[model samples]
Target: MGIWRIGADVLVCSRFTVSPLAQTMAALTALHKGRADPGRQAWLREHLPAYRDRLAGDRVEELLVWAALRPRWLADFMITPPRDDDRTFHDELRRVSETPAEVAAADLATAIGAPLPPELRVPDLPGRAAALLEWIWTHTVLPEWPRLRRVFEADIVSRTGRLSTGGWAAALDGMRPGLRWLGDGRLQINTYDNPPRDIPANARLSFIPVTTAHGWVTWDLPDRYAVIYPCTGLLADAPTSPAPPVAVSALIGPARADILTRLSEPRSTTQLVALTGQSLGSVGGHLKILLAAHLIHRRRSGRSVLYYRSPLGDRLLKPE
Candidate 1:
C-alpha cells in the first residue's frame, strides 16, 4: 500500500519548474514559443543523452524541460497560468509569504546545506535564491549531490502534505540493500542507474548501506535511498578481464525472456517468482545475465529487489 503502487501509471510529466502549476503554464508557454532558449541544445548534449529520441531535429530544450517537469509536477505548487483562475491558489500560497516559490525553494536549499544560487528567490527579489532555482532547472541534475538531493525531496514531501502513494511508500519501506544484488553481483541504484557526475573519479562507490541508521529516515524526503548507480565501471584501473558486451543477445533464453517480459512493468522478485513459477535460484541466474546484458534490471525497493525490464529491453522484447 505504498504511494508509488497507488499511482502506477500516473504519468509524472516533465515541466522544468518546481511546482505543478508552473509546469502547466510552462507547457503552454512552450506551445506558444514563450520559453525558447538556444543554450538548451548544448545543455542536452552535455548532460542528458536520453534527449536524443525526444529532440532529434528540434533544438527545443526549453519545451522538453517544461514537458519533463510538468508530468511529475504537483498541481498546487506551480505558478498559475495567466489564463487560469489561480488567483486564489496564488493567494493561498502567498499567505505563507508574498513569494511562496522563493520561500519553498530557500527552505529546500537550506535543509540540504548546499550553496544556494540566486535563481531560487523570487525573480524580483535581488539575491542568490533566484539564481539557484534557475541553475537547477537549466544546468544541473539534483542527484549529483546525494545528501542535498535527499534533503530537498524530503522537505517537499513534508510541506506538500499529500497522501502517500502506498505503492511508493511500500516500496521504500520494504527496500533493503544487500552486497550481492538479488544474488547477482551487479549493483543497483533505486530511482535510476546513471551515476551522478559529481562523484570523484577516485572515490569508490558503494551502497549507502541500509542498516547504517540513516536509512531509517522517512521516505517523504528525497535522498539516494534505493536508487543506485554502477560504480564498478568507476574502478581505478581497468579490469584485467575484458568487459562483456551489454547487448540484448546475451539474454537469449526462455526463462530470461519470460522474466524480461514480466518486468516490462515493475515487479518484486517474489511477485515474479509466483507469476513465472520459477525457482529463486533460476530467476536469480537469469537476472544476472540480463543485468550484464543491460536488459532486465533490479533495484532496491524497501528491502526488496524489484526487477523490471530496462527501457531498451522493452523495445527488444516487443518491437513495433
Candidate 2:
C-alpha cells in the first residue's frame, strides 16, 4: 500500500484533468500488455491493424516494443508531464523537446533499472523519445481522439459531480477499486510498488482518466502527483445503432426517438447535428424538449453543451 499524505494546500490546489498524451501512452501500454476490458480489447483488435498500416515507414512500432518491454521505465518519462490541460498534440510534443537531457536520462535509467544503453544515454535522448511519441500520436491516436475524448470528458464530468455531492473522500475513493481515503488526510493506494511517501503541501495533485488504463498508474512529478485511472462505463455507454422500439418511436417522433437512442453517450449539439444530419436548430429544439421532459440532462463542457439520456430516458427506451 502507498500512502499520499495530503496537506491543506495540496487539497485546495488539486484538480481533475484530461491528458491526451497520457491517454495515448496508456493505450500503447494496454496494447503492449495485451490486457484490456473486452470492449477495449475488441476495439484494439479491429483498429490496430489499420493503425499499423498507417505507420508505414515510422519507427513507432519499434518504440512501442521498447517501451512495452520496460513499462515502468517508459511510464517515468511521462511523470510531471508538460501538458496538464486540454491541449494539442503539437503542444505536448514541444514540451517533450524542452525536457532537460539529464533529467530524461536519469528517468530512463530508473525505468530500465539498469545502466542505459550507450545509444539511449545520449544528450538528445529526450528529443528522440519525443519524436517516437510524436509519431505514435500522429499515426495511431489522432484519428480516434475525437471519440475517445468524449469518453474522457464525460468521465471527468461524472466525477466532478461526485466531488461536488460527496466531497473529497467520496470523489477520490470512488474513482476505482483499491483506492481508499483513510481519513485524516491520508490516501491509501494499492500499487505494485507500495512505498509510503508524503506529498508536499505546496504540490498539486491531479487525477487523470484514460480509456486505455486498466486500473491506475501513479506518477510523482516535479510539480504534482498524478494518477491515471481507467475511465469506467465507456464501452457500455457507447451509442448503439439499433432502432428504438416501434411503440416508443410512435410516442416521440422518429427523429426525437433516434436522437434519444444516439444519446447513450453524451454528445454535443454539433455532434448530434453531424450524427443525425439534422440542422443545428432542429437538434436544439429536440434537446430542449428532452430536457423539459427530464429525459436527458445537459452539462457544459468548455464551450460545448453535452447532453446524455437520463435514467428516465433509458427506461423509456428499454423493451417493455
Candidate closest to the true structure, highest TM-score: 2
Would you list the C-alpha lDDT of every candidate in the order shown?
0.36, 0.68
Clashes of each: 63, 1
Candidate 2 to truth, TM = 0.72
State TM-scores per candidate: 0.24, 0.72
Candidate 2 residue-wise lDDT, 90-155, digit = tens: 765666667788877676666667666654656776677677667667766787777666656656
Of candidate 2, the 10-residue stretch with the lowest lDDT total is 60-69
lDDT of 1 by residue, 131-186 (tens): 32333333333323333233223323322222244423332232333212221212
Pairs with steric clashes in candidate 2: 73-111
Q: Looking at candidate 2, what is the lDDT of residue 129?
A: 64
RMSD of each: 17.9, 6.5
> What's the residue-level lDDT of 304 in candidate 2?
44
